[model samples]
Target: MAGDASNRDLPPVDVAVIGSGIAGLFLALRCFRAGLSVAIITKKSLSTSSTNWAQGGIAGVLDVDNQAALEAHVQDTIASGGGLCDEQVVRSVVYEAASRIKDLVDQGVQFDLSAEGIYDLTREGGHSEHRILHSRDRTGAEIERALTEGAADEYESGLRIFEDWMVLDLVRRDLQRPEKGVAGLWCLAPDGKVYTLASRCVVLASGGAGMLHLATTNPPVSTGDGVAMAHRVGADISDMEFIQFHPTALAIDSQHPFLITEAMRGHGAILLTRSEYKEWKHTDGFPSDFSYMNRYSTKGSLDTRDVVARATDTELKKSGDSHVLLVTEHLDVQEIREEFPTIANKLAEYGIDLG
Candidate 1:
């Protein structure tokens, strides 16, 4: 990073990437390896993005030889999209999953493996088969670590990383047609002075505007700065209406929303009502309970995230409760503790048992 605006001599670059999340860092790495002069501008340190807080895994069917699995993955995605998905795009991503997973692995992201020396895949909310590659529950953290280290190693090789800088707006070469016309960015340094850094191309990976919501699992940095800059420069922004909410979040003591991974439900955790929870919570071990999710969807808690979140919200509204109950007491406590040690320990801080 350069000095404050007064002392800085900003240089031109082939590409400028905003944000330090997985998308920005990965793209920056690829461009740097291609011998392009790359500069990454982030408002915070690389370790402070929403990606670091992501506990779920990346979905990829690595076994490319399995035609059935590949086709199933595509169908599952399209189905999850509820007839709104572009079939071509869904199939393209599904078919390319193996290659992308290989790319992540090449970047040194090590997923969990079983004793049989195979990748330990887990199934989440919507998927029919187990395809999620994770490092325990903190898959995103591991991926971010790999890319951050990769970027850090090449920082002195003309890979400029300007941290603690907020981009005010994107500069455009042409106002009439803004497609690929982004010239550079006007950014604010920590000292509150604005500076312009020119670039032939700029990539805005500044993540979503989830912080706009009254309650969200997004980190403080997710204020949609990149999107706002693009929109201000006459870029077309789509899917602003689709903000996904997690089905289970801990709102203890009115603190910021903390996500409880939905993988627990896929592992056979149940969502119970308050009364039902009071009745069966002390059982120590029970195979089944009344299917509360069945009232909303036939797939029950294993339904898609949007479906489950909506169901949970509706239940909260109807019951006039602050939250719906998600219990793992019936599941294997040892397996739960091992699989989700981070979540387990965090909950234990509040004197809550994950099991």
Candidate 2:
């Protein structure tokens, strides 16, 4: 059926959480576990989250004994932040990474492990250690699945999940009050009807506005809805200028673009200039020259996201090309296929071989 709320009289809840991504779902689970009645309002299906589209794994230092690795994680984060990072936030995240990772596992999300049965951590751009734990290339999807299943188990126990329902705005306690307290939200159901579901507390977990770009890896719902709602209700939002752009995407003109994970680069893939790609496209393997990225940093392909993206932009402008290339030709084909089945299959569908 369509809008389930529109079909019946809505009930008041202890908490109304807007959005159904990882953040929203996780918060809802916690609140529900605490015996609070909860309702999750999502604009589309629960799966249409940027969290689901994320290809790389969660970054965390699972080893408590590795003090050096933990400090390196913090340094790597600050270094990648390009001096704009808050030292406190970097320290907090680096230190708490192990617990947060354990939390995910406790919630039934399984990250990839090596054949030795330990977590198969991988390094990505801006990382000094192999702290990125992924479920192959579709780490986000696996996370979404686990979290959604976690919610499903609680559904009958007063956890309400409303998919295909859009949150229009936050209802304030008193418009004239000095401190505007949140009462609930105005939701737009699939039947084109608006309904007010009152709550003791309202949480906005709506995601970012990456789709504001002409081309982005963000989903359609990432149009700054949560920010706009909070802003309209007099909430102060900061650090919005910080938008992380994935440096590489499959750039076939006639096809829709998809992200080419930096994980590829982390695992010895190289970025080639347009001419270089065309010149060596058919070659079985390429030289270990570290051509394009070395021009930006000594780390070459393993450079930070901003550096690599800037390097790609510079290469494009200098060569008058539309896009640069992510070359995997030099890598082991079977290993590439096994390690990145998601990406390998996707590229294969486009008449392209990842290696």
The most accurate candidate by lDDT is: 1
- Model 2 backbone overlap count: 0
* Tens digits of lDDT, candidate 2, 193-292: 8888889988989999887888887788898999998888888779988888788888876333788888888888888886776666556446436367
Give stretches of model 2 more than 4 Å off.
1-9, 254-256, 277-290
What C-alpha lDDT values do all the predictions have? 0.85, 0.84
Candidate number achieving the greatest TM-score relative to the actual structure = 1
Query: Taking the tens digit of each residue's C-alpha lDDT, what string does model 1 give over 1-355?
Result: 5432445437888999999999899999999999999999999887779888888788988889999999999999999999999999999999998998899899999999998999998888889998888898788899899999999988967788889988889888987777747889888888788889889899999998888987788899999898888889888889888888887887685537778888877788888778667767566545345646888877787889999888878887888888777878767899999999989988998889888
What is candidate 1's TM-score against the reference? 0.95
lDDT for residue 20 in candidate 1, whole number 0-100: 93
Superposition error at 318 for model 1 (Å): 1.3
